[model samples]
Target chain A: MAAAAHEPEVIRDKAVMRAWSRCRRAEGKAVALVPTMGFLHDGHLSLVSAAVAAAAGPVAVVVSIYVNPSQFAPTEDLATYPSDFAGDLRKLAATGAVAAVFCPPDLYVRGRAGHPAAGASGGAVSCLEDAGGHAHETWIRVEQLEKGLCGSSRPVFFRGVATVVSKLFNIVEPDIAVFGKKDYQQWRVICRMVRDLDFAIEIVGTEIVREADGLAMSSRNVHLSCEEREKALSISRSLMNARTAVLNGNNHGQQLKDEIVQTLKEAGGQVDYVEFQSLTFSLD
Target chain B: MAAAAHEPEVIRDKAVMRAWSRCRRAEGKAVALVPTMGFLHDGHLSLVSAAVAAAAGPVAVVVSIYVNPSQFAPTEDLATYPSDFAGDLRKLAATGAVAAVFCPPDLYVRGRAGHPAAGASGGAVSCLEDAGGHAHETWIRVEQLEKGLCGSSRPVFFRGVATVVSKLFNIVEPDIAVFGKKDYQQWRVICRMVRDLDFAIEIVGTEIVREADGLAMSSRNVHLSCEEREKALSISRSLMNARTAVLNGNNHGQQLKDEIVQTLKEAGGQVDYVEFQSLTFSLD
Candidate 1:
């Protein structure tokens, strides 16, 4: 409601975003940046809404819709990543409090207008071969948080995520940023990185949005077959079962994870990993 | 010579430094930061001088003297690392142009006054164990540059270096920062990090200053035995020989490396590694 009357500005350049954020900062206004890999869903809208709620008044909500390449492994879904810019902007606008949508083509690559980093801007994107031949090599990592959970399977995942998020924080200089709890580990990683680096940015975690049947909303959810989608319900059901078990005083982590693994297995689902980090979102 | 008339201020508080920098920014004054691990040798003084030279008109030169903990491994010399705070300050004062000397006891460790970052300032150093039990876990890494050279041997070395350097940059916000080329690989890593991260600070590399005998100046040079010191000269001599071989168009890489290894071996030095990467300081 604080930003209800504000019209959202669509920005493509990092300099423009910075200048915009700077103007907001000079006006003593708080800026909240919601960084997403696009393909927006109800879950992303929830995060954008949370970003809006994080500040009292004079808030600038900028949602970045760049598909960060660094977070994906060479063999992962980067090439197959989904995008619907028109829909994403429409959803962002529906949030009412959103003030800007940053849809840079590239945010972390050596080529394109994405962030104009990697190589100096104004140079042709094709000059990557002449401008040192590989993607930008700097990385930011939260060693402890990235060590467990999804990090064990995808070693480069958190590194890429942390680096790009760091770049965004630098570019926007946001007063607050929001991440969905569905990405519990990633949310924690971002929070720890911000605290450790003394960025003076507050990281807020928005609750996960779920389907009516309790399937956690994800862009990757589009990849599941109809039968696989049915099987996926077991994953959520297992978490709910674990929560119920914990409520009944079954605090043993290994036992809870074993139960979840067995439940998923019985439901015709394959578990890539079943880790229990902290009783925190190690559960999520 | 411009700094000759200005007395340096010793600031331990990050807030004070930021306020001072903000004041400088308002006055259109340029600032140069010289980051050092501070056993303050003539080499570090040269870096300070270079930082001073990098800026024109009104300039503020800041030299950070904290011995960063993240850069040292557990088995490395962190515990026994030498510190001569009084002597270091004397040398920093001798630089004449330095506007501030930031010598926090702990920068990467959450426990010490090292920037008083993790918790609010004016708190006792004892707050670390109670505040947070572990060392800071966030790291900044240069993917390509850190893969070779000293990095191959000390895997965690550059991550620690990069993270601490990044923290320093954020804390000081200097207009220009200087790295000495005695550490050519590290210099490159810092340059790449600054460029890739979109840090507006200008990164300048000062020429390596060496002793009359040609051994590069280093804080660790104090730890070498007389016999080992002479043996180390073979390492430099071998490099000079390899340079001559390259200039003579004997471009066989292995032959040149073997020549250096053999020369060091003959001089009672053990070669830990021999590598060639982009003609950079892959040997460092």
Candidate 2:
């Protein structure tokens, strides 16, 4: 299929989603979803490509472009996160994505209840509400996968991801959903969630898309200064170097992790975490 | 719409559900879900009735007939719980339900990879696994709501209810889901969950169906001896008396709660708990 050029229309209402789902059902087409927080990069596009390839007929790629406030930590950069609807639309159009972009902030964040009138618009704003009288704070916990790496640093991160992804899964009712392997643990956690929850959707993990110099493509990549951009390449490079060492008969898991940590530390990046485990994890 | 008496076709696969959903979509029917552990009682029937009334068009009443082992406390009954599928189907048939009974063993449980024999059925046979390759024993935590009443006594209870309800929500995708008010705290927790998670489905709290002598109907009521059955009626009587007192300008929450506890204590039944919160609580 040739990719379209113009921006796709955006849809916000649940009634519209149900109507769209009905239309797709009549056409005997299976829907596919690629959920993102909408600072669309090549990595997200790779996931979209995977979803398209896996689906049977005219694929409805429901790109949920919401920066969920619940996922961010108190000190995390939720307020400064970048979003570009026009640019994101242009990229999705080029990918020949069928149907509209689901760019509903209030719908995605607050559900049927409209977004609270906080009176801040057109720029970065804090979406945190006081814990008082806010009834629903229950979270989905993915036991082992959420205890290490990014999870240790950002505690409530995966809870927010699980909840929002769940909402998207219900809203889109996708046959297949895609995730980037760059967020390795996140992908694994979601896979476990789908299996545990018995969601019929297939989860496809795509390899991380990288810049020419091997820095992982991220919306947060924009936050880094030029010097930090160069420094971040060391993360992927260090992983590569560690892989080589393990392949050369260095089979000790702790030693491999330490080597990766040391290599990253030498490259002038603060180490978040480096751990290794058997890759035999599967969706049964 | 006239309620008919007929056996609804049972569907177990995703393809069948897709076809059914598509057919319903074509007919523009709204579905209502009534989730239960399936030892059919008057309370459960009341929920089915509520679902039938709330749904528009050809209402699909999905009665999940699994005795969800996850929700039961180890000290409580998990092994010898009553299950009568053939009888339950007959009861559902009487409701004129276009219901699909999802009866899968380990079908919803996530099993260990490479261990195909693990979690093979949806019954009491599967072991819950965490990421660490160890057994998962943790339960869902619903901060303050779980502190009083049943939560304090049955620690793992609401977690099991929440998780299983979440699974049911995904599987059924109902427009409105019904729950009996017999388990008042369970209904409250589920309402909190739907509100917190931003689920698009409506949660309807059906009034507690009772016997002629004011005994709340329950599957467990079958386990109670004739003497225990007599003792159970006192709990409901106390609740009604408390309600009457509150209606007569008694605003003191603690005093009302204490009265109910004293009444239950005077009778033969053990007092689990009695709580009074603001009227803001509803199945939103």
Candidate 3:
């Protein structure tokens, strides 16, 4: 707790971050990780808080602020992804729970050791071409689970997410990691990656944080016009109504999903999907 | 040195293997890993010797003996792959360089937990289905590197190698790992994976050990007839001739490759390929 009162030490080098975690573990302190893509909102901070609360005893919380480029398709908003490093640091500092801030400029850049044999580059390369020259080509895929939901639209997204998170897990070596449930498929894909790959880390999913009017918190919310923002509220409202319906013994999956879709369209929003999944993420 | 006099402890559980490495690291001892598929040969033991020599100081060398199922295609020899657990232990014991033997029964099983939402399984699933029910869906691929050469003939091999080696790296947390140059592409793929994925470990590729009669030692050699085995000698013989040819200024890639292929065919052997690759694995 004493360490948290001040701003967390920012770590740019991967080695420094790893060493810090190793040193803390040697002192019998548990390390918890909260991975984020900068521009922290309440949802991201809630994950930080959840990491602290989830620990058995005293814990060192590391918040990584990286907008991983691998998860974005070339046509996606890689260039315009929201960011505020100074504000993010301020927000993390205000929480008084973070022990360190890992803000690497690029995790995909080849290190001092060059890889000339990386072969002629092609196939699902990380979206960002390193300004230093050379693309990172190693990829992690969760096969079947990465095929539906957001994956259908953003084909390369989960591979990017899984690969970057794998790097963070290796670099931080956290005993536990916290993820916001708002990115539902992503959280499950990560869980499956950890499970299937035998990473010795526990994954904790925290609830979605919303504004008072019930719009899910997202850094990209800044890009929306006032009219668009109001229309988005229909999604959360219909979800709440559907939840009420389900609890009131109207638990039919299709009927409930149809209601949410109707509500969103009536509010002038194009619906992509409104699916109900089981605890294990099988579409019900 | 004291450990070399006794048989190494065989570790079956993944968690136990991780804990052993952790405890050793906490005491300031470095750990080295040599991953194998359990049919030990002199070629394998040489790797252990190399692992010991490669260490900067006294190191705890762990040899993992798991024939990873994920890297095999359905038509490949997952079921028929050779095994000699007791004999492997004796051979490793004879070397006296090993500190532990990690021989897990299954790394891809769903652990103590279940994964019912793994979705309808299809697409490059691991060759082995878990008797316990759930299939392991997570896979790692070194996209570009895992193509051509052996990867062309055995498409799933390098993916299996990369993924399982990743599991071993995570479980063993070795300070350095020794791989036989006999698996040239595999060693390079791992090095690339370490760099691309930011694994904080050193990779050492050891020279391939061969039999006195000039046959490259392989477990599959047992299945060959005596006459067939005699014919197989042409492959290594031709390779040696090619090396001599290159050293003697006959370095034309196509001309040298043609000599080896012609020799193999004349000796009643099938020529797959005789490639010249750069240190970084770029085919000449």
For lDDT, the strongest prediction is 3
Query: Is 1 or 2 the stronger prediction by lDDT?
Result: 1
Taking every candidate in turn, the Cα RMSD to the unseen true structure, in Å, is 7.9, 6.5, 4.0
Which ten residues in a row are the worst by lDDT in model 1 chain B? B119-128
- lDDT (C-alpha, whole model) for all candidates: 0.76, 0.69, 0.83
For TM-score, the strongest prediction is 3
Listed per prediction, chain B TM-scores read 0.85, 0.80, 0.89
Interface RMSD of each: 7.5, 8.1, 3.6
TM-score of every prediction relative to native: 0.77, 0.84, 0.91
Per-residue lDDT tens digits for candidate 2, residues A30-125, read: 777778888898888888788878886767666778788757755788879988878888888887764667766553333233433221111112
| lDDT for residue A38 in candidate 1, whole number 0-100 | 88
Residue-pair clashes per candidate, as listed? Answer: 2, 6, 2
Lowest-sum lDDT 10-residue window in model 1 chain A: A120-129
Q: Which CAPRI quality tier does the interface of model 2 achieve?
A: acceptable
True contacts kept of each: 0.63, 0.28, 0.78
* Backbone-clash count (model 2): 6
lDDT of 3 at B73: 72
lDDT tens digits by residue: candidate 1, B130-149: 33455576767676687667
Off by over 4 Å in 1: A1-5, A109-133, A222-238, A241-245, A248-267, A273-277, A280-284, B1-5, B13-23, B73-81, B109-134, B212-215, B223-284
Q: In model 2, what are the clashing residue pairs, if there are any?
A: A136-B196, B105-B121, B105-B122, B105-B123, B106-B121, B106-B122
